[model samples]
Target: MRISRLRFPVLLAAVSASLTLHAEQTDLRVSPPGWWAGMASPKLQLMVHGPDIAGSTVSVNDSEFVIEQVNSLDSPNYLFIDIDIADISPGDYELTFTKQGKEIYKTIYTFRPRAANSAERQGFTQKDTIYLVTPDRFANGDESNDSVAGFVDKADRQAPGGRHGGDIQGMINHLDYIASTGFTQIWSMPLLENAMDDHSYHGYAITDYYRIDPRYGSNALYRQFSQQADEKGVGVIMDMVLNHIGSNHPWMKDKPAKDWIHHNGEFSATTHRRESLHDPHGVEADQKAFSDGWFVPSMPDLNQQNPYLTNYLIQNAIWWVEYANLSGIRVDTYSYSDKAFLSQWTARLTSEYPNLNIVGEEWTTNPVITAYWQEDSYRADGYDSSLPSVMDFPLQDTLVNALKDEETWGTGLVSLYNLLAGDFIYGDPYNLVIFGDNHDMSRIYTQLDESYALWDMAMTFLLTARGIPQIYYGTEILMANPDTDDHGVIRSDFPGGWKNDSIDAFAQQGLSPKQTKAYNRIKSLLSLRKEHPVVTQGKFTHFAPAEGIYVYFRTDEAGKGAMIILNKNEAENDVQLARFEPVLKEFSTASRWGNSNKISVKNASIEVAPKSASVWLLQ
Candidate 1:
């Protein structure tokens, strides 16, 4: 019924010419699209696609199997082979491709079965406290690999944006410290190879998609980190970048095609007008500027519109997920790529892992703009999406505004009040990733003007509020980077993490009094969060801010409730508790974390200290 695209006469002539050359024939180049260790069927369906190699047979070990599927058939490039297994086992086996009876190509495949009950089986949800860390700046466990081959930059702790010798072994050593801090998930910046001359330590500009940087560790070491993190009750979330590749990437040396990167020969900088993406009155020039512009000449924007490039990117992500056994993926600069390609990528990933979560970085200060990228939100333009979560930029913007302004008509705590009220704009409000400060901004301590009380109030609101809260590393020890937004200052070396480092915040050795108090206060919150299930999984309810005081509560059906009160005024203020009575339904008493006796909130007004926050457990 179908005409063959390949003419038999031409094909036979080419084969005859090849034989006349007297060249030795070799095996077909076949690769699986992607694979995972565990599956309900304990079987794999590989989508094998390559050049002309018809009548080729597939076999696992010595047994032969037939290809069950042939997709894109008129041209017919793909063949799907499925394998079945009864019980899960761990070992290596070879898969072979043969023609008639002789072998053409053979590749070894490994299946490592996990225990019947593995800690990695746990999935991410609305209930998690995520800690974001930059491994290069977090700590240095092995200094031997600081100066690596093929990388232009060397270890220079003094350089504001240089590598600092942090590796997989460093994180491994701190497993107990991370677990003890009450963080359920740890999301590290990309550890892939970025062999550029400047700012490569940040790990955003990727040189190689498949290999881990030797400076960080080997692929095997990364797998060990995942396994160890799982045992320590901490989930690992990988930072993935699909929009761009390092300029020095090998592909740039000899591109697969001229269309591999956008505006391949022409280099232009982006206008950084993110609003142009959704701007109704925006021009084509604006859209082009946002989409085609270079982030930096070193970070060449990849053209996802190219089918070959899209396949490569998608397969790369799937490979990392299966290889590292990653729990989740945090996509960087999510909106910069082709929208259609993004939908396809998201759909394919979710199709493979139904319940797995993928959070995107939609850095819009407006709720509507950010909400448009979420999974189920309706779009006027009718764009189908498979994205699940987005960073809460509206909340971050409001928190910054509220800290700088006094109580005005629509300002101060009112900014925060109105932001939370706009949760209706989002499809899944609880799935948003909320944070006070991250690697991009100044440290939380610096944002609060180095004021301990303001910092405490910020932490209280972040922890007690809804959505998944992410804490930046070193915030607990009051790391400060004032005046200069130098990333190295914001990402200061962890105290006592290295051998020669005299200052030890972990054991409180040689720390200032203020640093000691801040460390202890943060540690207390970490411990408290673990014991309170309501904080992890609960509905949020906020009360009006009056006289420099704001109140909120997190409650669940299990009768668990925690009250958070923040006072930002210079003087002490008494907050009326009657308004929150409805949430205190069956509770007869309330106890402060450090205090013993139950306090009465029925008809009393509580006096909160100036610029401080207090959390109470209602019984």
Candidate 2:
């Protein structure tokens, strides 16, 4: 086992204080295990754990490395050593531990080299379409690691919430299929170790922050997968949980500090009142309950107010970005953590990797609440979370409502126009992650009540509208959870993921007519975004919904652009071009985006099919 994992005998077991120990027979554990020599910050804090290790003196023989301080928490078994690694050579360095004037232990620590231009790596932008996947339900490529020992959540294909044996290898095997679908980025659910007995497949309730779950694959395999993904033109984004962790985590039994967890590690449910953070009429107790309460009985909310714990989390995130070569991060439960710590966390991360993007999950349909968590552009309170982006929950809800509601003066497509009219509240609307549906909600096809036409219309708007687009796995073939909104069913196993599966979505075998059409529609539109390029960066201009016909134009600086027309009318509608003449007059020729047919844009009125979308490239 690598020293980075901090592998050692269980720290919960009692041990004799006077027992003699050496490198070969010691219970000591150190993290991160290794660090890069060159970083924006030179200080590295090593959390050392063992029996009676708190009072030991740490020393190094090298002059380049300096031990800043040794801090002993309330626990007698842990030591936090702060060291300066500025300009240190990339190699192994030995450190000795002495106690009571006697040499007790010695170990070698390593410093690694940063990959070329790692600090300048670019993050996902509007040009990239993100594919979200539920890892354990995505595929099962490694049968050997199906039910790893000590992890009670064994693979049970019949159980909706049970582990289905998907691993990093499964994703690695299907990179070509994903890339061919016109996706430029992949955002998988939490890939960290969730050691719970059941439902550990989601990867959200992390047990060990540094170790990847053995069931999924080793840490080495994950890093290799990310590097390989880059070769296929697909970037990787890690889903991180900063609010809480599994109750079974080792820290629950052997805490480094008394206040490491909120409410003394007991269960106190959070009100989930994110608006309380900035609510004008909220009480202090309600705000405290929302920020400091546990998410659930099995998930212990972390106390980021503790400075030591805060440093540990900040360092852990930086370690993963460096180790896995990540393109971005999606923070789960963004507003649940301490406000002050979140600001510090994001500032440090962005400072270290200036070009990296970090999007937080603030699930609120209120644009005002979501905008408060982003950078200062849309905020007036002078409080900055330093977050680069946030999920567009308002727009997602609006889109779904717009598609399903009956067309009326205030309902249906008009709701979409009204919601987006308030986009000015968002600091950078283009940076928000817009999606039809995610793992937490019913599938987009299901949300549209299984209407193939409505689903395709939603896909067209999602792909060509403002902001970056993210599609859930299996949505290409129009996967849906019709009977229920159970997350397990929503994140059901993908077809052809297992070898003996009856169907193969990847191979395009045994698909219904609607499924096939939906698949083709998504691929065609996504490819248009890549081919046209203007849609990703063009200025958005839209006409309010009128008579069930809505039109929007994506115009670039060169006056070249694309036009998206969505029609909800049950009968064919003639969309008058007079209102769009200002933008459409410049272009006399137009071609269907997903098809090869060329049409004239100078027509006074364009005939649009009933409940269909018309996308055209203008020239």
Candidate 3:
């Protein structure tokens, strides 16, 4: 059995004592650990854990909070307390536990003060460009905590799958670099404890819901990182897992209920038929296999159908958003969780923070399947989703194929144009998160067969597209995993992230001619998006692809926006201005957005470089 050591939760460790079953007595463990008063929702559920603590009636001595109900299940070690926390003041309250009229346990519960206008906060939007990072491979700012005592995964730079000493301090150390890159937001993989014995660097199998991994940093440090990122004009987006937990999680050792885990805590691999959730004629057993099955034997699928477990997942998500003061969240394996519970989960979160953004990962190349989960899309089955955004897998797939495949009648760039033409299916197309590559797949550079020209065009189109653009960590420097798709190789450590590295990506030292150009071009494109409001809030328009050229435009009603052209020809081509007369006729001249050069539109055509993407600002 994999052993996991429990630590005091971040917000609430004020408990005095509780029933103990071990040789060394430990305080009562509470999830949420604590909560704040004056929240939009007056409800709070606390999952108190210890040894044989059931059959204990809970009571709040103070009138500020009321104990609505107390429930104990088959497990002798767990208690669920429902409290009405509407007007409680910010302080400690004594919770007394009695069994058979005898005081069995007592503890002090803490309530923290809410930040000013917290509920009125907004999440990441089309205006923000997100930089996706893998914290373990990004940088290692601290080596002292590289191999902690409890976590089995140790630091081994030689092993591609082992931890490489990256910590929260590394992210804190690079905020200036991130901000200078012109990205307004950062979405790293989950930083929660993974207490497994092997390959835990990916952080997908979570061992604790309320605590940040010590190998990454303490929970207090994570909060500090979020606050500091805000100082640099960049928001933090958390990656949350709702479908499964690490096999070593404390719950696996002592389940709160018999149905806490799906398939009775046994591993049953998923068929990975994600389309089953939306298939009109999908079989019931196939749907159950897709949702209830685990991704791997090492991770246990959660049973959200259990009401108590549902509350636990929802409250945990809210606690993180409030505790870390995060700007947004990215849900992992969104459809694998129970469908009804997902609706309730998202509704409760948005009800509290009305404008909050939560994007789900619904990895499918079909836009119709993706659209079935967004909030405003009317479903015939009467299922309403409160989710605000989804990762644009269709666009990502089409973009890569368009650039890599040979141009033909229905082959190359035309395929991409046709996909965008179907955008009417999405309720709010602009809210989607668009990207070329992420932590899960091979880097975009590798996918495009290491062609610098194709890489340049891909970056230009995605950055100017109609949705929130996200770029993987090292795309700017042309990181690639050639001849292999191993995740650890794709997520290799950044050049200057470690001590005594010969190459320093952060300082632009020891780079190839191609690498230097790639870095500069991406930085310029990001700056272009950041300074131009039309790129973020304007309507997108495009013309059909003819020959090897594809063109698009983004503009406000007054025609103040950008004109973009992507050329895949082997020779220079003169793009005819007559083809774009509707929006281009009003301007006699165009100013290059990134370089500030001038281009005259007074003639019938303009000459563009071969195999290049160009952008010009128009008013």
Candidate 4:
């Protein structure tokens, strides 16, 4: 059970009276710089940090808001104040710290009113095509921030794992390129501060939750980027890491409690066996080893069971969503954190913004394991995850393997068919986020062994298939990491993102015929998808794979429909139109998508290009 806030004031009052005799003037800091009033959750925990500040008698100058409790942890430098801001209006209020009845220090905190209908802002949905980017490698619009004064890692384009100087300004500069590419949402890798000595370009090892990486840009710049992206009809999905923090995080040096981190100040790597969470016969030791272990020696796993720490993390997530006006969030390691804490965290955020969408990374290829974390899932343990969405790793793996393997028995496309048939395991199949490849995985072009035909098939399935689709940066131009799966090479610099690059993908200059075709194909499909609501909000029907061909259809309530056919043969195959008579009964003509040519249904057969995926509109 969690400790009660009612007992905190009495305990802290005694400590404050004793420390007042030796109190001295000092600096004070509060996290979540400020908050807004009238939030769904009336409670707000302010983490006050300063030298010997925990024992100070804390009080708010305003009478509208009540200071429910003041908590002092094992560390003398931190104080947790729980305040009820339910009935308070938006305004400035002074937080005064008195020691022995003498005023020691005072600081002003602001509570801004929320934007009109801010809670009703829509989150990313199936209609959105998300483009994932690694900001450091995407572009460098601000050279000044490439190597900040205090940053440990500087710009080094030659080093694949080193910072390449991409900043928020670079993303802002290319908003038009993104919007024109048919991507409605941009899910950039973590842009939070990662003040590490090396390999910080990925932004996974977060050192500061509130501060944006100076090398990337300031916090205000990121907020501005989100606003500008919104103006261009694009939403921003922030990537966040909740499982661990960089070793250099301030908490590592000055921990508030002994159990703030797992392993009790010692390093014990996680078993990486994510299955332990749902394993029926799983032993207690294995579950503990998996969740309590550190991700790496450099990244410390946070212990979420600590109520103070839990509240801090929950507040931090809400702070970002409110401050940046984010459309969605992509949690880095979803199952690695404490399961109960995840429920609380997601529930609080959802309660605040009912329409917000959050997609968690489970990284498991098993449908059962991945689906277990979604909200309203059926499980033996009866765990109700409040998560709205999860990465479709199971479908992703099946899609890739099916496209690569030959059509033999229950192999190849049959595997994909079976996987889609298993969609019943998910509470909401459309809420799952589907992607061909991400920053962590090999590029789709490379995954398909650089075959343009296979690439086209994969993209067609991704865009037309149910659920939200996320395309990695440079996928439009067929970026490949053929040599190795090195993080640096996979997240390569965009051709036109920098100043001196001869090839500018944005301008469509100096691109090969194959690259141009791939780019145009994606653009056309995305444009069509944006115009067709049936693809985003329609009922799905699929025919089992046969003779190296797979067929599927998406139809809406109004009778509008789309048919997609995937042929894996090297020679053009004649598809008998009679087999699809059930769906094509009312239509007389079939026209290929992205083309004006129409063929009469009287022909009884349609010629499908070899080694290609095709979509047709029946009218």
lDDT of each residue in 1-619, candidate 4, tens digit only: 1112344456445545655654443356788788987789989999988877777788775687689999898898888888988887776665777767876666566788888887888999999999999999888899989998888898899999999888899999999999998999999999999999999999999999999999888999999999999999999999999999999998899899889999886789999999898999989889989999998889999999999888888889989998999999999998999998998999998999899999999999999999999988788898868899999999989999999998988998989999999999889999999999999989999999999999999999999999999999999999999979998999999988899899999899999999999999999999979888787777778988999999988888687778899999889999988777777776788778988868876548888989989988766
| Model 1 per-residue lDDT tens digits across residues 118-157 | 3234446666788898898777777888878767799887
Q: List the residue pairs that clash in candidate 4.
A: none
The candidate, 1 or 3, that scores higher on TM-score is 3
lDDT of 3 by residue, 398-495 (tens): 99999988999998999999999998888899999999999999999999999999999999999998899999999999999999999999999999
Off by over 4 Å in 2: 1-26
Candidate 1 structure, TM-score to reference: 0.85
TM-score of 4: 0.95
Q: What overall lDDT goes with each candidate model?
A: 0.75, 0.88, 0.89, 0.88
- For model 2, the local distance difference test gives 0.88
Please list the residue runs of candidate 4 whose C-alpha ends up more than 4 Å from where it truly belongs after superposition. Answer: 1-27, 600-603
